[model samples]
Target: MNSGFHGNTFAVIIAVENYQFRIKTVDYARNDAIAFQQWLINNLKVPQENIKLWLDVDATKSALNEELQYEISNLTESDRFIFYYAGHGFYDGGYNKITTWDTHPNNIQETTVSLNRILMEPLRNSRCNQCLIFIDACASYIDEQLVSRDFIADMNTKEFSDFVRSSNYRAMFLSCSRGEKSYGSPELGHGIWTHFLIKALNGEAPEAVERERFITSTSLQNYLSKIVPDYIKSSTDIRGTQKPWAEVSSSNTFIIFEVSGASSEGSNNYIDFIFIPERLIIDFENDLIIAYLRGLENDGRHFLMYDYEGLKEIDVEAYCIRISKLKNEIRKILEEIMDFLMEYEWEEEVIFERSDDKFNISAFLYEDDKTREITVSLGLSLKISGLHPMGDTIFDSEFDVANDELKIYTDSSDYNVEEVEIQEIFSDCWDEIRRYFLLEKEIEKELLNEIDE
Candidate 1:
């Protein structure tokens, strides 16, 4: 369900920037569409051949109909579909029409594609269970006499929900709500709403982490709700005018895109443990490491921790209490360590390698001749599960702190861990790694100078 190659997923993206009629051009419509198409192929891992893209003059009503009909005929319930439109949208003759490149201003209904007939009806009949729809339109300031109403109010109404709810998994994200224009920013090179959307889909959203950095409907909605409005309000022009809206109807959250390096197979090792507060703990007591697990059938029901050989039954309440107390003490110590670490330029967040009980993190040190970037990757191995500690032998030789309280924390999970003791342990490790990397750099420099001589 992550960013693995999903051949079954398909998309039809249309961006009508220049219309045949005398209509104002939708700014950045084409650029937005292109960005989204790239995201589908790169991030979502949808095949390039599976996507149908129509830009400017290429997006005719007939062409759109043909593509929709083709997918409707071929798609199965196992497959997923995505439809995106970025152009002029208006309401006329009791129906909302999405304007195409060949749409006529006067004869809108006959020339343009009807939103219900051409798009919604095809999706309703299509056998695909999951569908993602994104519409960015109604941005241009056109004469009301010719195009009639720009915004479609019913799109936000209950009837719109009923229409899309026919499919089990459906999410429709609109650029703006009723009476609002989907503003395009020259500064952003995209619609203001689309700007944040692309950013969020690229894994900038806060909710994206828990779901393994996958941008789901719920996550996107929450992100857009806060970010879009904040951007509008904070901007110099067009403040408090445009607000994006999303209607998601599904039993489960529908995943849209996974950020870079976010994949099911790539993150399989530390997926369960990463970001889980309980899993972050290093116990100093008897022997307990809380490991959160989720799988095919055992999803969301089991909170398990493994002992030595097999699943040893223990008091769940007492174990949780012990972990909670340890976590609180560790949290305070971590905050102090964070402050100390902030003085140095770190690469990214701390990454825990579960296979070997190794915590790997890196910091940028210096550049050699402005060509080679030097970074010291610290992999601190802790004693866990009766296994000998590996990685960085100098840590044991240089610092005795690891041999005392830190050593106990790694081996057992039943001791009363003190805050001051953990702080000293981490400080010794950090100081040792920094000194080691610096000494190595100096040695390399000396050797290079000797060779030059």
Candidate 2:
């Protein structure tokens, strides 16, 4: 069922910043949409031709449906589609409508695009199985004191959830809840909510890690769901009001994009790991190494480890598909490692680094119980080259860790794994090390009876 990473992802961006009718100025809504579209290009590697950007004058009711129908009609269940809207959301206490330039509150039913209709008919009926919907403008008229008394009601837009839950494999993220305002600041030059989103897309979210760096619906939701509330509470202009809502018809495990940044040595090469916690990161890297080894062994392929510089670059999506084939094995190895290291101050947090479809690795040392001399564990998550493309449809991801047979032991001194770098409390039992590096201990017992005295 895994389409892997090569699935064709299409998107439609609807940003209505100007209104020909009674809508108030929603400063920077168009800027937010434009920035989001660029993010799709830079991070997700979505083909420019696949994305449709409709802003201001063109985001009418007919245009939105026409775009969705055509795009969804072409896609399959193996592919993905996203719809993002940032502008005025007019709620008549039940029906939620995304307003266009031609939309007037008096003539809303006929003029505005019904979010429910698109999802129900064209989107649900389309060949595409998964839909990601982000609506950034909600209750704008009510929050800004612009709604007329006739439209105001004691009710809320909770019925919108019925439509949201109607579809399977769809995730919906709204800028605010039923009665809340989605804010924008002149300082940010875009909506504050959207500003944080772009930053998070670049791996700046609080949940971001050095190793596992792809942004997902869960990560984005966790980030915005927390930060937006904090910002509203902290700001003087607005407080105790706005709250972003994210709902998935099923578990939202979809990966949106990956982040790239400078390498650890301050070079332009995309870094593999950065700012990962000492214990959690080490185990992640250690397990992945084993995963790579186990996968290679299971596939009956020869394994070799070299500096990341030696690895070849290939297509990211294609590369990920290769990894997914072995991901189940990787997951098993991780579980075993967790059980094996239960005595250590272990946390399961982990991340990986890759770019252009090749992996680069890194891990740094820091003290635990900081005042004490930190125990340098048996493993080092060193940087190494990863899988290289074998052909158009296959890949080679072999790693052995040992360059030569018995070289790690006979020439153990050569490995930079001396006592200065390694610490062991009970010197005799290096059980963890033995299990990790596949070392077999051979102790010779001397016979005293054979001595001639």
Query: How many clashes (backbone N, Cα, C below 3 Å) per candidate?
Result: 5, 4
Q: State residue 184's C-alpha deviation in candidate 1, in Å.
A: 0.3
For residues 26-116, write the lDDT of model 1, one tens digit per residue. 8888999999998888777789999989998889888876766776668887788888888878665656668788877677668876767
* Candidate 2 per-residue C-alpha lDDT over 1-453 given as tens digits, one digit per residue, 9 for 90 to 100: 111256788999988787788667677889999998998888778899989998888887777667667776788877888888888776553456677767775765677766666654676677777777887776622432453111222113334445445665566777764434678878788887788877887777746322244555655766776687677667635432454666544322455555575223432324332111111111223332211211111121111111122333332211122333233433333345434445456332122222233332211112322242222112112222221111111111112223212111111111122342122211222234334444321211123333532
**How much is the lDDT of residue 251 in candidate 1?**
35
Give model 2's TM-score versus the native structure: 0.53
Top-scoring candidate (lDDT): 1
Candidate with top TM-score is 1
Q: How many backbone clashes does candidate 2 have?
A: 4
Clashing pairs in 1: 285-413, 285-414, 285-415, 286-413, 286-414
Candidate 2: C-alpha lDDT: 0.51
